[model samples]
Target chain A: MTTALLRIPAVRLATHLRRLGAAALVVASVLTAPDPARASREQTGDDDGCARDGADLPLAGAHFAPRRVEGGVAWDARFVVASDAASSFRGGALRFAAPLPAGEELVAAPGLGAIVEDGRIAGLCVGAGARSGRTVLASFFQPLSGDGASALGAPIAAGRAVQIVDTSVGDARLELVGAPLFEKHVGFVAPRAVSPGAREEARRLAGVREDVSASPIYLRGEDARGGLTVRVVDARARAETSAIAVGVAFAGVVGGLVLAARRLRRAASVERADALLASEIDAAAKEPAG
Target chain B: MTTFVTILDIACGRPIPAEDSGRARRLQLVVFALLASLAFAGAWGLAAGSQAAGLAIANLYKVPMVILLSCVFAAPAGLLAWRLSGAPVRGTDLALGFSGGVFGGTLVLAVLAPLVALYYQSSAWAGPLLGIGSAALALVVGTVMFVRGTIRRLPPGAPKLAALLPVVVTLGMQLLTLLQLAAIAAPIFPERTPFSGGIDHLAR
Candidate 1:
C-alpha cells in the first residue's frame, strides 16, 4: 500500500517540491556570498576628529583648460580640496576678482554643495573624510569674451585665498595663481551625461541650452601639511584623437575605393567600345559589300 | 510610400533583397555620405545644445572622423564575416547591406532627435535616457535588418545557424571600434571614473 501511494502522481509531486526547496536554499546562499571588491575608492578618516593646527589643514587647488565654444573660448576650471577629515569643508566663500556677469553661472558638480550668493559662490562642502585624498569639489564656467568677459577681468589675480571655513578647521584658503590660463590649440570635448540624474543635474545647473563641459586636469599639490599630493588632468584628448584618426582613415579608404571603382567602370566601358568597333569592321569585311 | 514601407519592413526583420546588387553598392556611397552627415548632426546637437552653427562646424571635421572610425572597424569586420559565411555575398552587396543597416538606424534616430532636444529642455534626466534608449533601439533594428538580409540571400538549404557566426563576430568587432570611437567623440560620464571617491552628497 505504501508503494502504491508512492507510485501515484500526486505523491510524486513531493520530489518537485524538494527540488524547489533545494534550489531556494542554493539561491539564498549565492545571494548572501561575500561582496566583491568595489570600484570606488575607500573612504579614509583622520585620527583626530578636528584639525589641530596648520599641519592638519586640508589643501586646496585649482587648474583650468581652455575650450573653444561658439564664437569664443571658455575657461573650464576645477577647484579641489585634499582633506583628511570626515567633513573637509562646512561652508565658505569662493572669491573671484571680477564678479561673474549675469547669464553666466558657476555650475557646481553634483554632491559638492555650492550656492551662488551676491554674485559670488559660497556654501562649499565635502561629504567624504579627507583620507580619500583629492576630490574635484567644483567647476567654474566662464566664457572668454563678450558679456562673459567681465566674469574674469583682465589681470585677474590668482593665488588669492579662496576661503573654506567651518567650525572644526576654523578657516582654510585655496590660493589661486594669477595669470591667464589658455592652451594654444584645444580640441572640442563633447559632454556626456551617463546617468539620468547626472544629465538632469547638468542641465539644471548649466542651463537647458548649453552642454556642461569639464575636462579633467589633475593638479598635484600638498595640503598646508605638505604630505599628500593629488593629481587631476583632462585625459579626454587621447580618446578624441583616436576617434578623429579612425574617422579620417575610414573615410580615406572608402573614398579611394569609390574613386578606384569608378575608374575601373570607365576603363571597362572603353574596352567594350574598342571591342565592338573591331567586331563591326570584321563583319563589314566578311560581308564583301557595303 | 513604397520606399517607406520597405524601410519599415527592413526594420521589422524582413529586408528586401537588392534587385541590382551593383547599383545597391553604388547607392551605399551616397548612404555613407548621408550617414556621416546625420551622425555629426546628431552628435553636435547632443553636445552643443542651442548652438546651430556648432553643428555645422562639427559636421565639417568631426563627422568625417567618426565615419572613418566606423569604416575602419566595421569594414574589416564585415569583410571577414563575408569571407567566413562562405563568400555568399559580393563585396558591394555587403557594403550596401551594412551601410543600409546603419542608415536605417540613423533615420530612426533622426526622427527622435527633436524629441531628445525637447526632453532635454523639460527635464535633465530625460535627455540621457532618451539618447541611450534611441541608440539602443537603432542598433538593434539596424543589426537585425543587416543580419536577416544576409541570411535571406543565402542559397536554399544552407544552415541558418552558420550565418549567425559571422554576424556575431562582426558585431563584436563593431562594438570594440565604437567604444574606441566613443572614448573620443563623447565625454566620459563624470561619475563612471575608476576613482569613485566616497563623497557622500547626501551629507549636503
Candidate 2:
C-alpha cells in the first residue's frame, strides 16, 4: 500500500499543490486588504483632515478696488493663484455667492471662460496651463448699481484638479480631481479717492469691528460653499475701550465720594458748635435776674 | 452756601434754630432743598442714561420730574395727616424736613453716579440691577433720615406717634407715586426690569 501511494502520478500531485497554493493566496489577500469604509470614517472624524488633504491645491487671493464707471461704481477685481513648487493646478472655477451686477461682463484671462446663468456672471474658469508656484491670473471689472461694496461676495475656487508629487510614495504622483478649494486671502483696496475715514466708516457700517492691519482677511474653514467667514481681531480694542471707560468712571466716583465725605464732616462740626452755642444761651436765659 | 449748610444740618438731625423755625424761613429752606435735590437726582439720571445719548438727554429731565411730581402728589396728604394727628409739628417744618430727606437721598444717588455709568457700559445684567439697587438704597437712607429729622424737630412733650403718622403717610404716598412715575419714564435702564413697567408689568 505504501509503494502504491508513492507511485502516484506526478501531474496529479502538482495540480493538487497548485490548487492549495491558490486558496492560501486568496485568504492572505482577504486578511491584509484595507477597509475603504473604515478609512473614510476615520478621515471624516478628523477636524483638520480636509485642509490637510488639499494642502497641495493652489490658493487664491483677491483684491477688489472700487471704480467710478459711467453708470455707477464698478469693482476692479484682481485674482492671484499660487501653490508650492511640487504641486500643479488646472481647470477650476472661481464662483461668487452674490449674483453679478446686471449687464456686466466678466473679462478674465486668455484661456479662462465665464459661466453665466440667469444673466449673471456666476463664475470664471481656468481652461489650460497647470498653475504652479505664484501666478497672477487676470484682472476683471465688475460693475454694480451702487458702490458695489455691499453687493460683492468673496471669491471661491471650485472643481480644481490638483497634482502633487508624493515623496512618501517614492516619487509617485497623486492627483485630486476637482475639489472645492478656498481663497487664502481676500481684501478691499480702497480707491485713491476714498479717504481713510470713509473706509473706516464703511467698515463700521458693515459691522466689521476687526482690525485688518495684520493681514488680509482669509476664509477660516474647510467649507468653501459657506462663503467667506471673517475672524474678529478687534476684541482687544473693545476690551481696552471698556477698561478705560470703567477706570475713569471709578476714579470719578472715588474722588466724588472723598470730597462729599469731607464736606459732610465740616458741616457736622459746624452744626455741633451751633448746638453748643444755643445751649449756652439757654443756660444764661434761665439764670436768675441780676 | 448758607442754605446748603442748613440743609446739611437738617440731614444730620441737628435742631432747627428758634429764629429760623419761623414759617417763612422754613418755607425758604424747603425751596432751596428742593432745588438742590433736583440737581443731585438729575446728575444720577444722567449717569444711568449714559447707555445712549438720547436716553441721557431724556433722563436729565425725567428723573427730576418724577421726584417733583411725587412730592407734589404726596405733600398735601402728609400735611392733612399732620393736622389730624395734632402732632404740634409745624407744616413748614415738616416740609423742610421732607425736602432735606430728598436732598440727602439725591446726594447719595449723585455719589453713586459714576459707578452706575461704569456698570452701564461694561455689564448688561449688572447695569440695570445696579441702577435699581442704588435707587432702592437711596430710598431706604432717605426714609431713615426723614424719620430722624422730623422726630428731632418735634416739640418737647409732643406724641412721637402723632408726628410719625404724617411721615408714614407721606412715605407711602411717595413710593406709590414713584412706582407709577417710573413706569411712565420707561426705558430708564438699558434693559427692562419689573420696576420699569411698574405694577401692570408685574401683574402680567
Best by lDDT: 2
TM-score of each: 0.41, 0.43
Residue range A112-209, candidate 2, lDDT tens digits: 55555676555554433423234434344544344212323333344222111110111111112232342222133222333445445433422344
Error of 2 at A242 (Å): 37
lDDT of 1 at B153: 59
Top of the candidates by DockQ: 1
The residue-by-residue lDDT of candidate 1 on A1-290, one tens digit each, is 98787689775698889999999998997777573211111212222222122122243444444444554334454444434432645322223333333344345343433233454332233333322334433444444333211222111112322211110100111112221231111211111212334333333432232212222211122111111111112244334566566666766765775675566555444554566677778878899674
Q: Rate the local accuracy (lDDT) of all candidates.
A: 0.43, 0.59
Measured over the true interface residues after superposition, the C-alpha RMSD of each candidate is: 9.6, 13.8
Model 2 TM-score? 0.43
Candidate 2: how many backbone clashes?
A: 0
